[model samples]
Target: MGKIEIVEGDITREKVDVIVNAANSSLLGGGGVDGAIHRAAGPELLAECRDLRSSTLPDGLPPGDAIATGAYEIKKVKWIVHTVGPNRHAGQTDPQDLARCFSNSLHLARSLSARSIAIPAIGAGVYGWDHETVADLAIRAALAEQRERGGIDRIRFVLFSKDAAAIWSQAKLTHLGR
Candidate 1:
């Protein structure tokens, strides 16, 4: 089974096999986690995103879908899996859509043979999802994937704030009954 841990820090600096970016549908880099990952990964990341847009996702990546790109400058990370989470007020009110972000990212990571991945709180930032909901959905998705697939070794929820970390920690405990 895969182990899940909550870490309070910047997701951009995580030294893992893959880093999950809570990206917008554009996948061209927006505010929050997407911008951070793009910036941290340097201009090469943007260039790659542009290539993806021009070739594959010309209409832009849709919510609940994920794509992987080379982690050019981010130290110790091989790939950056970008997933778009549902925007609640923008008409994407389905919790399942939010959950799909994690599942799709994990699936992409597994396809790349990634052993460990660091993920941020998808949909909880500018997307307007509540912290508790984000935490619950993220943890549940990870745990479900672990049980159903059982390939990835470790999953880390890297929160940018102490408050977010606390919420994720509580959710983890609540879900695991620990």
Candidate 2:
């Protein structure tokens, strides 16, 4: 299994093979992690997103699904794997959908032969999923993928705050028994 680490830092600054964006269905750009990624990656990222929308994901990406695009200006990152998290207020209460956000993103990262990936607290942001639930599901899905897929060498859960980091750390200990 790949090693899992929790870090309190900006996901944009993570020098990993890929950075997982907790994107909305639009996939164009939005607040929080999505907006920060786009901003750090520059306009080239937006252009690629537009091209993706024009050709493949024209109607926008769906919840629990993921797609990859060039990382553009983000240094040391080869690809940006974007996955739409299910919004609880939108009646997406199923935890499986949240799990898919991690599983699908990790699957795509493995397909790209990414050895390291940095992911944020996906559904815990604007999607309104609680931190504990998000952490549990994220860790479970990532650990499962690491065992089943085995390409990724490192999985880093990058959070924007110390509290978030602490929550993820506790979740990791609870789920992974470390």
Candidate 3:
């Protein structure tokens, strides 16, 4: 199985093959992790997202699905995987939908032959999912993906706050052990 790590750090600063953006359905950048990633990656990233809307993903990225884009100016990141988590406030509370965000991101990372990836607390922030639930879902999805497909060797869950890191760490231990 691939190694899973819980880190208390900024996702934008990760030196990994891929960084997962907890994006909105628009993929045009919003608050929290999405805005930070777009700002760090610069205008090119936004342009690419806009181009995606104009072309292939005209309907915007759907929740639980993922799409990859160039990291642009974000140092040490080759690709950015954008995923829209289910918004609890919108009454989209299916656990499977939240789980798909992690699984799809890992699937895309493995397809790209990414050795490592940095992901954030996808729906826990503004999307209104509880930290404990998101943590469990994230860990479960990552482990499932690892078991089914093993190309992606490292999964680094980069949490912004200590509380989130602690939650994810505990979930990691529960699901993956020490």
- Runs in model 3 deviating more than 4 A are none
Q: Please give the CA lDDT of all the candidate structures.
A: 0.91, 0.92, 0.91
Give a tens-digit lDDT track for model 2, residues 1-87. 779999999899999999999998888899999999999999999998989999998899999999999999997899999999999
Q: What's model 3's lDDT at 2?
A: 76
Clashing pairs in 1: none
- Cα lDDT tens digits, model 3, 40-140, are 99999999999999999999989999999999999799999999999999999998999999999989998988989999999997899998999999998
Task: List the candidates' TM-scores in order.
Answer: 0.96, 0.96, 0.96
lDDT at residue 67 of model 3 (Cα atoms): 96
Tell me model 1's lDDT, rounded to 2 decimals.
Answer: 0.91
Model 2 TM: 0.96
What residue pairs clash in candidate 2, if any at all?
A: none
